[model samples]
Target: MIFPKILRLDKAILATGIMAVLTASAVGTAEPQLPALPQAVSSFGATVCDGYLYVYGGHAGKTHSYDTRSVLGSFHRLKLSAPERWEELPGGPIAQGLNLVSHKGKVYRVGGMQPRNAPGEAADNHSLAEAARFDPVKRQWEELPPLPAGRSSHDVVVARDLLVVVGGWQLRGRSHMPLWHESTLVADLKEQPWKWQAIPQPFRRRALAAAAIGQKVYVVGGLSPDGPEPRLDILDLARRQWSRGPDLPGKERAAFAPAACVLNGQLIVATNEGVLYRLLPEGKEWEKVGQASRKRQVARLLPWDEHAVLLLGGAGGGQNHDSLEIIPIPPRPEPTPEAR
Candidate 1:
């Protein structure tokens, strides 16, 4: 005698299927079908904090110089919901054309330079070391420990709450010197003191873009003292090792700030020439992502929520930006339970 048997779907399988369907529905309804291409905001040295965008310390094209430094100290912050109006913040401890990062609800401005002498003279080039922190809650500014060396075109990023400043060149006798301190400094907000740790240098280059993805920081594309064209480098945070990555897609240029961010589990790099590139995890190659609207130097890039990125102004050759650019971030895929 034979008995007819019926198989029912497992509870876990049913749950997964339900989850996948719900996720697909949510994604379909939540995201716009097609996002408009991002446009460059004319403002340079912009920082986003507490849902407000801040622009500080960058000069217009006419005021900037090729040989000397250009700096502005004005601060302008705008809200995303209300794009038209820009409210001015109290101007103190201003750093123009520098990299800004936020930690513990406070914003820190680092690097960039200013000319001591009058404009048009290429002789008086100086980098800035004055580090300033802005407390959004208190709406006040406090001076923090200065950098060991003053550098303008270097990259500063926060990883695991530690602020690591990587390679940047200093002006010396009408030429620049490639700098690699090999020291990764950690800022203790609670402790009120800075702790320094040594890490291996990647290319000993400067004026590069630094992006912290997971535990590692990838420093991509910079100009060496000898010339603008050079290879790329990636520094491992855990093992203190340096490995070579893909080269820049175009001619090497310094003080032309590149913006680096992690999108869809991959590292994305954008150059001044409006070139967008992506770096894969396993491979040591970089492929083009998209073209930027215009050329921008010293541009900063940071994550804006989970699905978008904010690009602030850097000088576009002789042109400085007050324009703002926003790009929708691509979502990453999740692994299955069995794969995990």
Candidate 2:
């Protein structure tokens, strides 16, 4: 796959004085700490709405197995100002592995899967194509038009006043092999019938992360047919075409289900390997910032504010984690006069 050219830092600028300043700044900055989740969860969806962080259906339990019984349909929210306290909201309609997005102060949940019987057997696994919107004020869910197909582990983002659902996987055949998708669907919320349109397919992958940086929507990091893909696909809304973005910097091609968000006009992505990357506005490359406190896969990254982001529940190193950690993205320090 063709990767975008990344701008390299000038070696001459890294003088001893400049290096010292960088070192000091790194040491002086405090590491942001994450608070524990109310319960252990993985394959869940989270978003910030109305000053509260909302977490929706996923696998929940102490043991980190894929048992269907572990799937939950409950909803919970935490006030950003007082994140320590969590209040349980009304239950949702679906089980785990759904795509959750917030639009116009309301939360929309789309597509998920659940086991058909007890013991959470894979043979009885069922993928859902239903869609619904939750009204926090009414404490109820309103059904919306279903997706063209049932999908799980997809990435959803709101761009151009539309809900864009990207690639994911669907169970097919007796062996139940995961078939990765290349379909891109968009929903127009203003119409009476809830118009849904299919756009040209991008790449085929599952467990990807997506975020809208501007007019364009960026789809990043997932398991491709060849293996874990490190490339980023950018969809230009105006031109309606797919283009490549900078490849993630690491020997590992892809980090499983990394979290992504747009903060302070920059695209911030955190991988399961625990590294955080930031893409500046109009930049061709991504810069490594710091590491997450915990290495997690299938985690949800929610932007808390301009300076802070919350890494929610996910599995790590074959074990599930209920821990919640906050990563602070401070402004880049300028070189001091001593460097000159």
Candidate 3:
């Protein structure tokens, strides 16, 4: 199986000065600085619930490689106001690759991977379909109905009171080449008995970033069969159908799971190269905003409020980062009279 092509600076054209000016001008205002994480980690699941940030199941230490031993099951939490002080929570049953999402003040851990009971063994065969819901008030985890099939590196978002599991990868063979998935799953949170219902996907990919705006869910940047996916897809929960959106700017694959969130009625996406883009609700294209504080891959974006977002742990330059950066989303500047 062939891996997706990773984009490098030498292979792609750099951003023009005009684009830089547009981004820099948008971020001219001052914003509060964000604190770093308690420790460095990557491939972790994170979410915001009840004004607290929760992180779980990720890899730690520098292996320079993806190994099962590096997979961690630790759980941590901190108040968004004081992120520098973290509290250890009860660990989850599984290891890394799970996706976390919050609903009605509760946190849910979705499908992910775990290592088989062998020392230094590959975890390809250990993809999981199990899921659990955490009650922050009680500080307990309750088992929930599992998914129909095992998955890892998938995107999960809450839309219309349902949990939607998007595309991801499943290990195929000894080579562990990822078999990208196009199947979508939906779970009705308010149903009498919880169950997963299979749905159709517009495309197949894995390690993508997603955000929900109003009734629509926007999925962007992932590893497709050909390479890094260039198109953005939006799902209309009311219609239960997928529609195409604008393509991403530049040649960057947005690889290693870039971060995305909805801020002030606009969609904000941060690529692995630390570049940020803004998309209006009614706009046809994505506009470059500015660069984030750090260049990291596989990071998680947690919205603090309408004006700011917290970027969690990820890897960069062959090492996992323990830092957290605050990305401020200022209102779009008004067009000048000359331009108008």
Ranked by lDDT, the better of candidates 1 and 2 is 2
> For candidate 2, what is the TM-score?
0.83
Off-target runs (Cα >4 Å) in candidate 3 are 1-35, 61-64, 117-125, 172-178, 333-340
For residues 37-135, what per-residue lDDT tens digits would candidate 2 score against the true structure? Answer: 777888888898888888888877544344456778888888776666789988765467666789888998888776555564434556678888899
Cα-based RMSD of candidate 1: 10.3
| Model 3 clashing residue pairs (backbone) | none
CA lDDT of each prediction against the hidden true structure: 0.60, 0.75, 0.75
Q: List TM-score per model, in order.
A: 0.74, 0.83, 0.83
Q: How do the residues 70-182 of candidate 3 rate in per-residue lDDT, one tens digit apiece?
A: 77777888886665678988877656666689999999998886755444554344567788898988898999998887788788888758898888877544556666677
- Give one digit per residue, the lDDT tens place, for model 1 in 1-340: 2222212667787787775566456445333232211222332355567777766665553634533334456666666655666777766532344667777677877766655655666546566777878887787878878877776667777766777777765543346653444454445455557755556564555656877765567777766655564366666666777777677677766324577876544677778787776664554666664556666766766555555566666666566565556555445454111112
TM-score between model 3 and native: 0.83
RMSD values, in order shown: 10.3, 9.6, 10.0
* Model 2 lDDT on a 0 to 1 scale: 0.75
The true-versus-predicted C-alpha distance at residue 231 of model 2, in Å, is 0.6
